[model samples]
Target: MGDVGSVGLGSLGHPLLGAVVSLASGGGVLLSGRLSLATHEWLADHAVHGVMLLPGTAFVELVVRAGDQVGCGRVEELVIEAPLIVPEKGGVHLQVEVGEADASGFREVSVYSREEADGDGAAWVRHAHGVLGSAVPSSETQYDFGVWPPVGAELVDVSGEYVRAAENGLEYGPVFQGLRRAWRRDGEVFAEVGLPEGERERAGQFGLHPALFDAALHALGVSGALAGGSGSLLPFSWRGFALEAVGATSLRVRLASVGAGSDAVSVLVGDESGRGVASVESLVLRPVDADQLNAVGGAARDGLFRVEWVDAPGAVAAGGEVASRTEVVRVVSEGPDVVGEVYGRVLEVLERVRAWVADEDLAGERLVVVTRGAVDAGDGVEDMAGAAVWGLVRSAQSENPGRLVLVDTDDVEGVGGVLPGVLALGEEQVVVRSGVVRVPRLGRVRVSGEVSGGFGSGAVLVTGGTGVLGGVVSRHLVVRHGVSRLVLLSRRGAEAEGAAELRAELEGAGAEVVIAACDAADGEALAGVLSGLPEGFALSGVVHAAGVLDDGLLTSLTRERVEPVLRAKVDAAWNLHELTAGMDLSAFVLFSSATGVLGGAGQSNYAAANVFLDGLASWRRAQGCRVCRWRGVCGPRPVA
Candidate 1:
C-alpha cells in the first residue's frame, strides 16, 4: 500500500516515527517509535525538577505527523492525560494510532507508550487522546511579522525569562532556550523563537521541532497567564491545530487570551519572514507538580501489594531466654470442615467467644486460641472452619487485650515448642511454620499491566443502603463505576434520612434507583428484595455494607449485644453468599474491617463477625463460588 500524503516510513518518513503499518483488523494506521535521551539527546535538556519529561509539544508534533500519515492534517482536539517521563538510562516505546475516518471525515487518535525495559508484555500507558480532521485548507486570519517588532508592540525584558522558568521547576538547557526576545501589546504577548544552529539543520525533519515549539509557548509567562497556581503549568488540552508550513528554523509567535478570566490562549505562528507556519485555535494548561511527573509510569505498578510472613522472635535479655508464664488456657477448633457447614462452625465459635469473654473468673488468665492451618502463612489454608474460628477469637481478643492469644500451627505437635516462645514474643497473631513462629507483614508489589476499575453494564445491590457508608457506596457505584441500575436495601428504606434525596440525586445522574425496605440478616426478606427487582435490571454485583455495632468490654457483654452485631455482619454475609452461590456475579464485596483482621479493643463481637466474613470469602473461593471473589473493602468512610 502507498503511504498517505507525503508521509511514509523510512527515508521519506518522520524522524520520530520508526514504523507505520496499517492495522490488520481495523482500517487505520499504527505508528510506533522509540524515545530515549540517548537517541533523542535534546530531550535530556528539557527536565522538570531534575526529572526529564517528553515535552507536550512533542505530542503535538507526533500527532500532527501521524495526521499527515493518514491524510488528516488537522488536530481537531487533543487532551493529555498523563506525562511521559523518559528515564535517564533506558528509553520508552510509543505508539500513535489513527482510526478510520468517520462520516464527518474525522478519525479518533490516541497516543500510548510504555517503558522499553518492561519488555513486550508490559502494559501501554495512555498519554493523550484526540480527534484528527480532514487535511482541508483553512482561511483563518494570519498575523504579519515582516516588520521587525511591528509598529505598536512594546518589547518585554527577556533577560530573566529562563531563570524564572528554572525556579518553577522548568530546567531548560541551551537547545530548549529558543526564546530570543518577546513583545507585548493590548493584552497579547508575541515572541520570537528559533532552534540552535546545530538543531536548526535537522528542523526540516519535524513539523515543528518540540524545543522551538515549546520556547514559543514560554512567552505566555510574560503576562503571568500560564504561571499556574502553586506549581508550574503545562499544556493539557489543544484544539483547532493546523500545521501550515514545516521546516521553519525561526518562528514569530502570537499568544492571545481566548476570553476574559480564561487561562486558555490562541496562538499564531509564522516563519522569520512573516509567512504563516501554524495556528492553534485554543490551548488550556494545567498545573503540574514534581510528584506527578515522577509517578507517571507508576499507574500499572500502583495499588499493588502482598502479605509476607516474617520471623519475629521473643525480646529476650542478653544470654537469657524471656520467661514464659506456665499458666495458659488453650481453646482448639472443634468445628466440622464440611463445605456446607460454614454457618454451623461460625455459630459454634461465636458461642465459644461469648462464653470465654463472659468468664470474669478466668479473666486474669491468658486464653490462647490454637488452630491448625487456619492462616495462609507460607502454607495454604487447610481448615476453613478453623480459619473462621480465628476470626471470632480475634475480635474477642481485641475486646479484652492481653486476655486472649491466637496461634496457628502446621500440626498439633508443632505448637508444643513454639507456644511458649510465641507467648513470650508478645505477638498476638502468630503462625507456626515448620516449628518456627512467624507473623504477617504487608509488602509492596509492582506489576506490568493496565489497572482498570470500570464496572460492567448491570444493576448493583447495596445493603444497608440508607446508612452513611451504604449511601457513600451507592453514590460511588453510580458516579465513579457508572452503575446505571441500583437496588438499595435498608430497614427503613426511603424513610431513612436523605434516602429519598439520594435516590433523586442518582436518578438525576441517569441511574435507575430502587430503595426498598428489607432486613439483610433475614434470609427471606433479602430473597424477596432480590426477586422484586424490575425486569431487565438483573443484579451483577453486590456490596454487603450492612453492619451493626454494639461495642462493650467482655465483662459487660451479653447475647443481646453480640446477636445483633452478628446478624448484621455474619448472618447477612452468609445469607448473601448462599443466596448468590448459583447466580453469576461479577463482584460480591463484603465491607469487612481491619478490626477483624488485627482485632480491635472493645469490639470483640464486631471483630468476630468480620472474621467470619474473611473465612466465608475463603470458603466461597475454594468452592469456586463468586461471593467475595475480590477482597472486601474496609473503611469507616470514603474519602471525599
Candidate 2:
C-alpha cells in the first residue's frame, strides 16, 4: 500500500495516462489521472444493476500502460477489490501505482480512486491490485491457430451473448457486447472478439487498448464458468495476467480449463497471425449476488427503516422472554375509532424488530404474527388488522426463504397453550384454543385439478388488471379459459404508464379489453362500475389483483404510510367481495401474495392487505361460493 515513485508524464502519448508520478529503483513507474463521465462518456453506459461502473477493461488498460513505462511488457495479474464507481456530476481522481521490481523482474501494480473534495478531505479507495512482470522471449511452439477454425471445434452462435449475460444478471449494454464468434473444441473454448467499429481506431493509442482487451475477455463467454445460465460472475483475481504484444484490434482467444483442484482458468490472447499477445496464467472469477448488489450499489436507498427479518427462538413457555429479534406482531384490540393509532403502534414496533434482525441469522428464525383475537372463521369481517399482518408478512416470507408463522390467540401473555408447536416454525398458521394449537393445512394440491369451469364465453371483470401480473392473468383467461369479454379496472386503467401497450396486446390477442379508471377501494365507486357493466356481459368471473406498496419496518409504519397501502388492498378486496357475492360467478379469484402467509420485513401494511384477501376469500367460500386464493409472491426484492 506504499506510495509509488513520483515522476513526470510529458513523454507518454495516451490521453488516459494523464501524468507520470515517479520511477522506483527497480524501474517501476507510477501514473495518475482525473477520470469522469465527462472525459469518457462511454463508461457511463456500462452498468451492473442500475449502478454505472468502469468496465474491467479499464483495469487491464492501466496495468498495460504501467507495463510500458516500467520497461516491462508483461502484466502478471490484477485482483479487483472494490469497483470504481463514477459519480453523477464530477469525475474520480485516480492513482495507478506500480511497485519496485523483483529479481525475476516482476512489479506489483495497483489502482485507487477518490472523489475530489476541497483539499485533503477525500479518502482514496483502492479498487484493484496485482503484479507486472517482464516478458522473456520464448521460442516454444505457439498453438497452430493458423488453419481456419480448429479441426475438432464445434461452431456455436454467439449473436445473443449479451442477452444471455443479462439472464445471468450481467447487464452488458451495447458498448460491452464484444463477443463476435465462439467455438468449443476438445476441452478448449476458442473465439474471435472485436471492439465496436466506432472505437476500433482509438484502440492503438494506449499501451494496451481497452476495447480490444475487453473483447479478449469477452471471448470467455464460451467458458464453462457461465454455462450454468444462472447468476452473474465478475473477474475477481488473476495470479499471472502477463501481456506480450502491444496492440491488437481483434483478438483470437483460446480459453482452456484448469486441473480439477485449481480455482484458476488458463487463457491465452493472441492475434490472427498466431502470435501471442497477452496471457491470463491463472484468473479467478467471483460470483455476485443480484439482490445484495442492488441494495448497496450507487446512492443509498432512502427510507427510515433498515431492518432485516430475523427468525424466532424455539418454542418457549408462555410468559417466558421471547427473542427480541423475532418478528412478533402482538395484535391488540383497536377501538373502532382508533384504527389509525393502532396501525401507528404496529409500525413502530416492527421497525425495531427489522433493525434488530439486521445482524442476526434468519435461516431458522420464525416470524410469529400473534393476533390477540379469535381467528376469523369466515362467518363475518373481524380482526381486519390481524388479517392485514398475515398478508404483509406472508409476502415478505416468500422473498426471505419463507420465514413467516401466523398465530391467533385471545391470550397474548399466556401463550403456554401455543408455545410448543408455534415456536417450532413448522406450521403456516395456527390458532390457540383451550391450551391446544390448531394448525391449518392446505387441503390439497389444487394445481391441474379439475376446476369448476363454465365462464367459457362471457365478460369477466378484473380489478387491478393494468398491473404486470394482472396483465399476465388476463391473457391466460382469454387464451386458455375461453373468456370472450373482459373488464380491466385500475385507478389509472388506460392511463397507467403501460396500460395502452397492455390494451393493444390483449386486444390484438382477440378478447375485448376495457380500461376502467375507478378506485377499487371506494365502495361506492366499485359498486357503480359493477352495476354499469355493458349489455351482454354476464360478469361470471371476478379477479381481484389490485394492491399498493408503502414499505417500512414495523417501527416506521405511520398512519400516513399505512392507510394508502391498506386502502388499495383491504378496502379494494372487500368491495370486490361484496359486489360479486350475489352474482352467479364461476370464479372469484383473489390475488393474494405469499407475504400474507410469510410476512415481509418493511411491508407491514402490504402484508396486511394481502392477508385481507385470504380472509375474504375464505369468507366467500363459507357462503357456498367458489373462490380461489392465489397465494402469489413476486420475485425477491432486497431486504430492508
Best by TM-score: 1
Badly placed stretches (over 4 Å) of model 1 are: 1-304, 310-365, 378-389, 392-403, 410-418, 421-426, 433-438, 450-458, 475-482, 552-556, 627-640
Per-residue lDDT of model 1, residues 465-502, tens digit only: 98888877886675445578999999999999989777
After best superposition, candidate 1 residue 423: deviation in angstroms?
A: 4.1
CA displacement after TM-score superposition, residue 58 of candidate 1 (Å):
12
Q: Model 2's lDDT to the true fold? A: 0.64
Which parts of model 2 have CA positions greater than 4 angstroms off? 1-11, 23-28, 102-104, 117-120, 139-141, 223-230, 261-263, 291-640
TM-score of decoy 1: 0.55
* Local distance difference test, each candidate: 0.74, 0.64
CA RMSD of all predictions:
10.0, 22.3
User: What is the C-alpha RMSD, rounded to one decimal, of candidate 2?
Assistant: 22.3
Q: Least accurate stretch of 10 residues (summed lDDT) in model 2?
A: 631-640
